[model samples]
Structure formats: C-alpha cells, structure tokens
Target: MSTRPAAGRCLVDLSAQDRLRSRAPERAPMLRVLCCPPAGAAAGYWRFLVREDVHVLGAQYPGRESRFREPAAPTVEALAAEAAAAVAAAPWARAAITPGASADVPLVVLGHSMGASVAAELASRLEHREGIRVALLALSAKTAPGTAEVASTGAGTGAGSDEDLREGLDPLAPGADAAMVRWLRRLGGTPEAVLEHPELLALQLPALRADLRVSMAYDRFPAPVGAPLLLLRGTEDVTVDPGGLEAWRPVSTGPVQRREYPGGHHPLADHGDRLLEDLLACAASGRSG
Candidate 1:
C-alpha cells in the first residue's frame, strides 16, 4: 500500500481551545491534568485518565488526528508554547496558586517519552511565564533534557531506529517505511501486531516523524522550576535508566519524587489505573490551592 494517507483524511485545523478543551467542564474539578501525548500519539492516548472529578486536557499536537492537516510542531519549544497558550487561557489559571487559596485547582502536567520533555517545558511556562503554579510536573519514560547520557545515546532522537522493512517482508505483502516501525518498537508503547501492520502504521507516520524530528533537533532544556516533580519509569525500561530519572531532581526546586512500575518502556500501558490512584494521593496534599 502507498504510504500516503487517504484523501478523505482531513487537513483542516481548530483553535487550541476548541481542538483541545477540557474533558469535562461543568464539574468543579478537584484536580486538573494537562497531558502531552508521547511521540507518534494523539490526544486519545490519555483517554484512560479521564475521570468524573478530574479534568483531563491532552494537548493535541498538530499533524495528527483532528489536526492532521496542520503542520506538525516544528520543535519541542513550539509545542510547549502552544500548550502553554492553551492552558493559560483556561479559567483555572485565574485560581490563585498561593497556599490556602480557596479556588485553586491542583494542576499537574504529564507526558511520556518525548512528551515528557515537552511537558516539562510546558510546566515551566505555566509557572515562570504564566504566573500559574503547577502542583506537579510529571515526566515519564524519558531522560532529563540536556543530560549527557541523552547526547551520548541519541535517545529520543529517532537515531538508529530505521532498519530494513524490505529485508523480511513476505513477497506478497506490501512494503512500508520501517523507521517508525522500529521507533515504535524501541519505545515499547505499541503492540507487536500493530507494529507489523504496515498500512495502519503508515497512517501514523507523518506525525510520528514530525515529533521525532522535534526531539532530535530541540535545543532548549527546561530551566529549573519551583514546582514539585513526579518521575515515572519502568524498572526494566532501557529507554530511561535510573540515573536519567534521578537527573530530573536538579530541574525542580521543590520535591522530586520517583515511582517505578513493572514493565519495559510502556509501563503506563498496564499501570495507568495505578498511576491515577497515585495522582489522587498526590493531589491530596496540594488540595489547599
């Protein structure tokens, strides 16, 4: 099959507010979670986190899903800017972040893999630029930005990800690009059957390639922020080691906490329920708003 997406695949765009509004607006959210999807993913990836008392806002990156027609974010900073702008406009930001503020909604910014880096940057903007307080900045499955280990390994750069798609394909099966396939497998977030299904995988390649390019080319690392941090990693995840998670400590002036799950790169795939339970516990302390 051709790698090009089908014609009916949309090319229009929406304002960030309309494209990525709160999952539930009527309820007074006990906590607000602004999430960034991992490389190759879209807003739907965080659907599991939606709850009646929680407001989930998954920043929908361009060039995928509903925004498939728009240009993909050129860099991590640009994506963070978009998310910052969107969340800054929300009504929740008006809530005071000071201790004991009555209306303050506990805000958390979360992302996994390349999204983790983007989330950190977004959290920085929310706190430093928007004058908002992010109760928790959660980074999952990625090393701290600007860490020497990342430079040494080309982690998140999509480097060394492309291998032969032609080498082992059956004679009758159609050929597809292999770079995304390899990267998805490397990240361990996607299922094996989906990785092998070229047509479906190809449909996701445009956005995936764009996000990988952003990760590979980004220059800015998040400046240290005052917010507390939550670092999540899979115990067996080769993509991010213990040192990488620990590196995040220096990026925050407040408490830096870590949680390990039982899996490889995609620990959340099996443990999102557990993660939500933990986040609820996290919010309890920050609820004073």
Candidate 2:
C-alpha cells in the first residue's frame, strides 16, 4: 500500500464547507454516497455526483491527495478494510432509518468498476459491524462476488491473491516508468507531473495493485443485502465487460434498476445530470424532505 493521509479525512476536508451548507433538517440527504474508485483512480473521479439532494462522500485511498503520503495497501481486502475503517470512524454514524422512525433516510451507495465491489463489501461490513441498513447498493461495470466465471473475458479475471496483484504490477518498475507513463496517458487520468515523477509512481504503484486486487477478488455476500440494488452497465464498456449485470437479477430483492447507456463504462462523466437525476429519484418525497 502507498502511504499518505487517511482517505476519510481528505474527503471530509474537500467537501466540508459544501456539506455544511447543504444540510437541512427537512431537506437533509436521503442518501450518503460512498463511491469506490477503480484501479488507479481516486475518489474525486466521482465528483459529478455531488449535489443538493444527496450527501455524496467519496473515499480517497492511500497514495492519493491527503493520503498520498501514506503507503498504499497491496491487496483489495486491505483497501476495503481501510475503507471500512474509515466509514466506521466517520462522524455520521446514523443508520439509514432512525430507530423507531417511520421515515428511513435511505443511503444510496454507488460504485463503478472495481469500486463497485468495494462498495458491496463496505455495505456488508456496515451491515455486520455497524448494523446500518443500506437503502441501495449500486454496482456498475464489475461483477458481483461469487460470479467471477462471467468475467473471464476481462483483462485479469477471478479473485487475485496478494502475490497475483504483485506479479501483475511487476512488469512496470523503475525501468518501465516511461511505458507506464504512456499507459497512464491512454488511461486519461493522472497529472503530467505525477506521471513524470518517479517518487509519485512509487506511491501510486501500491494503490494500483491494491485496486486491481480489489477488482479481481471481490465477492458479493451470499445472504442478500437488506437493501434495494441497482446495476448500471455501459453497453460500450469494453474494459470491465458488462456480463455481470445479467447475474444481479436473482440477488436484488428490492427494485433492481438495470440501465444500458450509450456511452462507455463511466457514464457519469458524459451524463452527469441524467445519472444524478436517476439516483436522486430513488429518494422518497418524505425522505428527501
């Protein structure tokens, strides 16, 4: 794992001012989004989801921003564990619905690609440890756990061990930084400076591997999560492969809204308002108030 600051603290600082202003007793958020980023991506990647209707919280793993100084985790489990710890430590510990209250302040958790798996695990952790109910668990672009056979066409399929993730990243190193930079360029993320800086890669390498592990090895809980679920697939997404969406049907007890958008995997990047509208629409009138 790459070492930086805590992922939770960075998110809190980045959105603190806006979050305070958006808080209203009647109009408080019906959902608190905890977006997990795919391999090599950071929490800010989902900044498009932030709005007045929902309290959006994005988790920045180690080696990114405030947490950039901390060593990154090497495995997906470690990353999820870190995320689970962060969620547990966060100040907003209230359950989706207040105890004995008729109105359930729903929490809609959205994860894209690898982040989707982490979101599911986090939700499970929240349910088992904190006993908080997840109103909705939205998994996009990635397969739900125990459904790895469907992801055979992906670049690196199946749950990966720590050694597997380490080996996967072994091809790039001090000598292959240039090749890595070229790869990052096509990925369309990461700053030029970060790409050029050897030190930064040293920090990011762990995060990249950890993210890949999280993506590869994530398993959905067998016992159905006590929440509505959604699976969003981009018809054109060639990277993650949309095969997993079909498998979600049997698992989702509540309304399972599966959408096939025209764009590639990251639909929110091009269809921010549309996606936000869909997410916000899940909020009940009473809950939104």
Top of the candidates by lDDT: 1
CA error at residue 9 for candidate 2, angstroms? 3.0
User: TM-score per candidate, in order?
Assistant: 0.79, 0.74
Q: Give the alpha carbon lDDT tens digit for every residue of 148-225 in model 1.
A: 443323444334223432221222344435544654566567778877787777677667766766775664567777
Cα error, residue 271 of model 2, in Å, equals: 1.5
Error of 1 at 185 (Å): 2.9
Error of 2 at 134 (Å): 1.1
On TM-score, the candidate that comes out on top is: 1
Q: In angstroms, how far off is 172's CA in candidate 2?
A: 5.1
RMSD to the true structure for each prediction, in A, is 7.0, 5.3
How far residue 153's Cα lies from its native spot in candidate 1, in Å, is 7.1
**Candidate 2 lDDT by residue in tens digits, 1-289:** 9553454554442244466676633346655677777777777787766666567777677667666666656655566566766766666655442554544456666777777766766767766666766667777776655665432233223553323333445555444445455545543446788877888777776667656655665554534566667777767665444555656554445666666676655555777677766665653422333
